[model samples]
Target chain A: MPDRANDPTDALRRVDLVLRVHDHQIVGPEGELLGNVDDVELAEVDGRWLVTGLMVGPAALSQRLPGKLGTWTHAVWSRLHPDREPTPVVVPMEHVTDIGSAVALDEWAARRLARTLGLELWLREFVVSRIPGAKGGSSDERPGDLVESASSEATEAAEGGSESEAALRPRPDGRPVSGLLGRTGLSPDGERLGRLRDLWALGGPRDGHPEPLRVTHLEFTSHRLGAELGYSADDRQGPALVRAFFRWLHRNDRVVPISALTGIDDTGRTVTVETTHMRHPFDQ
Target chain B: MKKFFAIALGILTAIGGFVDIGDLVTNGLVGARFGLSLGWVVVLGVVGICVFAEMSGRVAAVSGRGTFDLIRERLGPRVGLTNLVASMAVTLLTFTAEIGGIALALQLATNVNPYLWIPVVGAAVWIVLWRVKFSVVENVFGLAGLALIVFAVALWQLGPDWSDLWRQASRPLVPHDESHTTYFYYAVALFGAAMTPYEVFFFSSGGVEEHWTAKDLGVMRANVFVGFPLGGILSFAIAGSAAVVFQSQGIQVDTLGQIGLPVGMAMGQLGLALVLLGFFAATFGAACETGLSVGYSISQYLGWQWGKYVEPLRAARFHTVLLLSTIVGVGTLLTTVDPIMLTEYSVVFSAVALPLTYFPILVVANDRTYMGRHANGRLANTLGTFYLVVVGVAAVAAIPLMIITRAGQ
Candidate 1:
């Protein structure tokens, strides 16, 4: 992996922080609630975890709820959705806009994808589609219209799809990256470093790869919670007072380049990185 | 001619929708006690709001993002989170007060207990939010709130000594019995009541909801400039009426009924009826505004899509927040807390919470990357900077003074 110490475009947060986002409401492009982020699907490549999709249905909810409650909920959920797989409903990461107070999705596109999945079917049949003025009476320009066209486009593409092309492509050997964040990191010599706060990546296409983005660095903080973007490896251009304060607050934050990463545990939680190549958060 | 009518309509609605429960309660209470002494604060707050509202409105028009949408990008997550918490708390408190205010307005009509009206009012607010179009909600209430003009008419008809009212307004000081701390407390309250953070949040988000572009900037400015100051005058009329009738009688204004007593005394039953209708519209309209603002600020902060333009089910989380907020509002009011007293505290706390909303707006309005050519000009910067200092001082002083005065006891 390239060691760009001052990369500023790595603002994406870790998916293991899903615990904090468990009950958080998910909203769509039109500011509607799609659903809560029940669980995240992870894809691991080269011993590093990356979020591939989000699980957002009753199955996902059962995974988060603990003990008997979870089992009973799962039983009820399974009964209601007998054909539903026990696995969480998957929403590809591409649909997510941000991971703030609510996980926002691109409603027009997400709806098409979600329709293909069972979650939208459950939601429509159980809730929205049944409501008064739910179908098309609400607005002249309905978002449903967009969903209709997208589904049609999806059908045409499915008819024209070639499995041979996918077989010919070199897919990344990635593992699921769920629940791997917020774990402690240890130096090779067994000294405690800090907890994993967020993973920074060189987002977008890299070397003409069709992949979403490549993780470039792991940001660790001695502080309890994660650092904001201001604590990113190379984001120093904001108000002087704010930058100065955050700089001091996040003084102990360290950014380890992917090159310094020695290995990650099989669970993909605890990370081991060579301390020699590590840089201070403020190091230019 | 068509564009001209739109501008006129915008300004008229702006004026009609300006005053909320905060203004009615604070101005009336201050007028009865301080007798226009804190009047200048309303003017100061109006100018502050116009300056910031225009800036945020411009940012929304130019960037197609609400002020809070860009808040995290500019202020970073920590500060943005702090701002969101502070502003959201105050906005929620204001929402509760508006709901209570709606109940009180209804109680005036039905003579039923306001407590009984709380659930019904909450249901109505939820229904409107759940089903009503954004323009319909905004226009219906915005235009209906113009009935508050009766306050100004009643003020004129009551015909208090023009010179004496002028004398009280010109000489800005604590009256003999009131301490300087109490005087400043109410001043902050009046200031806060005029420039509630939710107003700008609502205004900017309303711009986003309405899909205002750069062309809408002119109409937005007209609304801010012409409409808001005129609305400030209406606030003054509310204060002036209280100053004339309640001040002389030494009866401190405590209830919504007392706030409208001067109108009834001046314009008979017909005028009083119109003013109450005005109260209902203003408070109910403001309830919707503040409730929507609560959702907007949170959704924008977290990057969740939020707006009433989408169906309730589509924006389920936003609607969920609104539903929960309505329940919380109803629950809070059912405690039978005096809505007037609640309104007073909410605005003073709103004074303390001002800097959180204003700072990001100033920062973003000046950012050339987001705003491009529409960034804050020299005049805007000068005025914005001036208000920043003023807002800072008020924010620092607000809580301390509130503690000292026991919330303007």
Candidate 2:
């Protein structure tokens, strides 16, 4: 990979992963929706958290839900899958070309990825395709349209790259961003700070491609409600009453750089960071 | 000249498509019982809908995202799921009521039992949704629903004391016989009827389907400012005619035929025919809208490709939802529930679900990240904030008022 650390502008481009990326719709190059970014995969590399891939399907989405609902959804998803034990589908970060109102996959990746939607495939083949008027509309992307055009070279490159990258790392399984949220954060002296609310990542170009966003900071707050409602962001959103209310609610929120982190104990569900490194999120 | 005609067509269709089964039933029921005393509520509801519909349409045009997509993005999964369930339930309820309304209108025209017509109506609606182009479905029924102008004509022909009606409307109060609770309950119902959430869902989704860009904003604003208020006048005419004919006779509007009787009394057979046609078009048009809304909300929330612009096979999940919602609507109507009652409750529950639907639109419309230079202006923001409070109040008061007034017994 190109030396992204040398690029001064890379550190200035920040995106709040949970707020801006997770749960966004994934669109094909032709504007056809493939699915949503149900969850995101993060790998800890060289003591830095990096977003590796975007997860899709009900199995991935179920983990984001709370309480018995999450468990129930996972159970239902597992029961419906054709595999005896199915892993959630992950689209590698390299395939993602843009993130805006929707997460857009590159043309080749979109075609290959669209084929993996199990329900869409089954419903199209068994139910919709049999209907008399199903094929009559103006849309150019019909069933099997993209699948036939998916070149073998693109597929092999994507799969091979992911596998070789995994082998080279020889690390533990990539952790889900959802799994990291809500874990307690502590100061180096073991004083409780707050719960981890969101991860801030820096996005930039490296090696002629958009780099996997590197997690640069961790947001911690006494509560998750204000952040989840998107009040933590600095933009002045409307209906002045609601904006004021949520802004007041999230006043205590703080952010600290990943470099300030001393240790992360996943099993114990806590991260130890130096309090001196913490700063107000909106100060930037 | 072509541009002018296109704008005129959009405005006319917006007027015609505005009054649905909820509007028909609520306006008729309120007019007969409460007279023009509750007219201000319709005015409020119309302006409120105009503010939010324009916002949603603009957002869709600029961002190319439907209302539910923003709801999910802004609210996150757990809260977004709750919003999805609530909004879907209300839209589905409205869908069921609209299908029932079609059957009721057909029953008036053919003298057949609505029970016999429910299944047939459901099938016809499904076939249209399945086969017809989105614009054709929107335009045909929308223009045809203009037949409802008979209510305005009938109102004029009835020659009621305009001054007297204006007196009641201008000096809003609880009529001597009506309790304050019942009067307010109908006010909320009328508001709900005027600004049902499905209208925004359908409007924004329709924006995406038609590929609206910043250029279409002028035409869209014309539709809202000119068309919807004119449609609100049609609602007033419905009430005015009902007040002239039915209120004097102490006839509470309980059936679709009764709602049309005022037209028959004023303009004879031709008016009755026109009114029935209007009822058919409005209900059928709204049934299509609400049905598509149900599919649109769920598909948009889950990020499934959804639109009539696409081949049915490409957006299989969305089409499947449309099919299943149709079946469920038919099933609900088949339970022998009174369609008028269904329309009433649907409107009230629509009142209950309003804030959840409108809140996200307001938030997203103001966000510069999505809208860039097109973000909400001061005027839009002021109106949006005011209406959010109004919607919140109505939502909070709706169910309690329903219980207290025994659903406006």
Candidate 3:
């Protein structure tokens, strides 16, 4: 057993036991299995790592803890489980299609997982052609596309990770028009100011202008202005005054216009809604 | 058979997701307090849940995203962080309440102080999430939770004036004894419990976990549509049992035992035993849901590989969060705070946090880039839109009503 009283990091380093079972799949981000790890045994003391033990069926797992549920769970698991002379499914790590922040397993692992996940049966009999009005049965409908959204999956994953790859993906067909940009940020000299939060028209009718996102009232949840970082909300007069002005500007849900934005970064989830609602009217 | 099985899976998820600890208590409390009158909120809440849960499912199915995923993208990092903080706090509170309910259930059965059982329950919940297969975890609790439908049978056996019960139910009102503020407070509480944010968090995350495609939407919808109302009917029967017994007798619900009183009064010891069994099953079932929900929110938001699918060592962060949250939940209950009170507050906070969770879903559902042709049609949008407003009003009014009603004294 691992010692808990010892420093966890140090003990974890000192821990020597290791286990590796062939066909032990390394499942990735979207349940993508990145090949079977042939070996998995932790290092101990100075440096000693090996696929010390082969872990196959649930029986091997139950050996970790000797108990009723564990014993029976392993027992039943090994029993009803189908194995006609089990030749372990093997896929070397070389088949790994893409390995970045997220490792994309090649079709081998994906297919195995899909089968293990009952995807084949689900698609063939249950899911497909079953909906009250499903379109063109299995013509161009990609099964992988079942989980992928061109805009959202790419964008959402990027937001949580890095944007470099997501930026390369195709941009949304529609772009924010000029009318939607609300307040633009400007330098003191009647220059254009940056726009604030875009109030999305949440729910609208199916057709006709899919909800024009009006850059709504600016809400400063946090005062992360570069110089304003350390300074508290009360400490900064610039933000406080600007916030007060906006409070007056946005007494109701009315749209206030500024000058045009110089540039907008779609990948950054930001709009440079540049406008001349300059802090000062008598500038320049 | 496979199609039917998938539909059954959806229904099972709904059944598992349906009656959290708050609903277990509040539905019964309200039933005892105002009978079927307050029942409208659950019905309203059911419609509200159907609209949002479907939107959430569609968003998850169409977009391959979760709640906080869309929030951070659309709300920006700063505000997204704020939303995260608020949403996580409320979710954690619900997490705490569910764990408390689990321990309380044990207490009801074993006559042991729930405080002693807190740690044990917490550990059990974490272990199941860690090792147990996701399908088994859901199905076991879901099937066990059906044991709670006994409340309906007990209600029928009580043999009371059906007309009076039906009329009061048809016309829910602020009871004469209870002030309007108190009545509205409970109403919001009921609404919040029905539309708890974790429901969608778990639902969408589960969709992602089960690898749901647009094809699975029908089974998913079947789960939300049929299962929630089935759960809703169980909740109504709980209220009915209370109304037949407690309302006329001037009894009020202040504990789990009080809520079970109608059953105890009806069939003596045997009925009481069933109610206790129901309590244990429902609370334990909810503990599993809320427990998974904690891991779901944190991991989904961070985009950490999470779910019952992965081994414990691989998704260390997800399991770690689950462990810590469970510990905190157990500790909170150990402080001698009443779990029932915790359940009530959860419903209120659930109400307050509704708009934050639901708004993103509503937005994402309407996006053509996301949902494609699957984007919500007029009927869905109309219902979804109206509920959004309804949730907003309930959220806005919930806090003030609680204060005015003095926690619905």
Assess every candidate by TM-score: 0.73, 0.93, 0.64
Per-model TM-score of chain B:
0.98, 0.99, 0.96
DockQ of each: 0.09, 0.40, 0.02
Best lDDT among the predictions, by candidate number: 2
Please name the candidate that would achieve the greatest DockQ relative to the true structure.
2
Give the per-residue lDDT of model 2 (tens digit) for B117-232: 99999999999999899999999999999999999999999999999999989998788888999999999999999999999999999999999987799999999999999999
Output the chain A TM-score of model 1. 0.56
Query: In model 2 chain A, where is the ten-residue run with the lowest total lDDT?
Result: A162-171
**Ten residues in sequence with the least summed lDDT for candidate 2 chain B:** B366-375
lDDT of 2 at B119: 98
- lDDT at B308 for candidate 1? 77
Candidates ranked by lDDT: 2, 1, 3
User: Between candidates 1 and 3, which one is better according to DockQ?
Assistant: 1
Per-residue accuracy of model 1 over B1-409 as CA lDDT, tens digit each: 9999989889988999999999999999999998988888988999999999999999888766677766655444445667788888899999999999988888888899888899999999988877799988888898999999998999999988999888888888778988998988888888889989999999999998998988888899999999999989989999999999988879988999999989999999999889889999999999999999988887776545468776554454466677788889899988878888888889989989988888778766754434556766778877887888888899899999988888888
Residue ranges of candidate 1 with Cα displaced over 4 Å: A1-109, A112-199, A203-211, A218-226, A229-244, A247-256, A263-284, B51-93, B106-123, B156-171, B266-270, B294-306, B316-335, B352-404
Superposed model 3: Cα runs more than 4 Å off: A1-189, A196-284, B268-270
Chain A alone, TM-score per model:
0.56, 0.80, 0.25
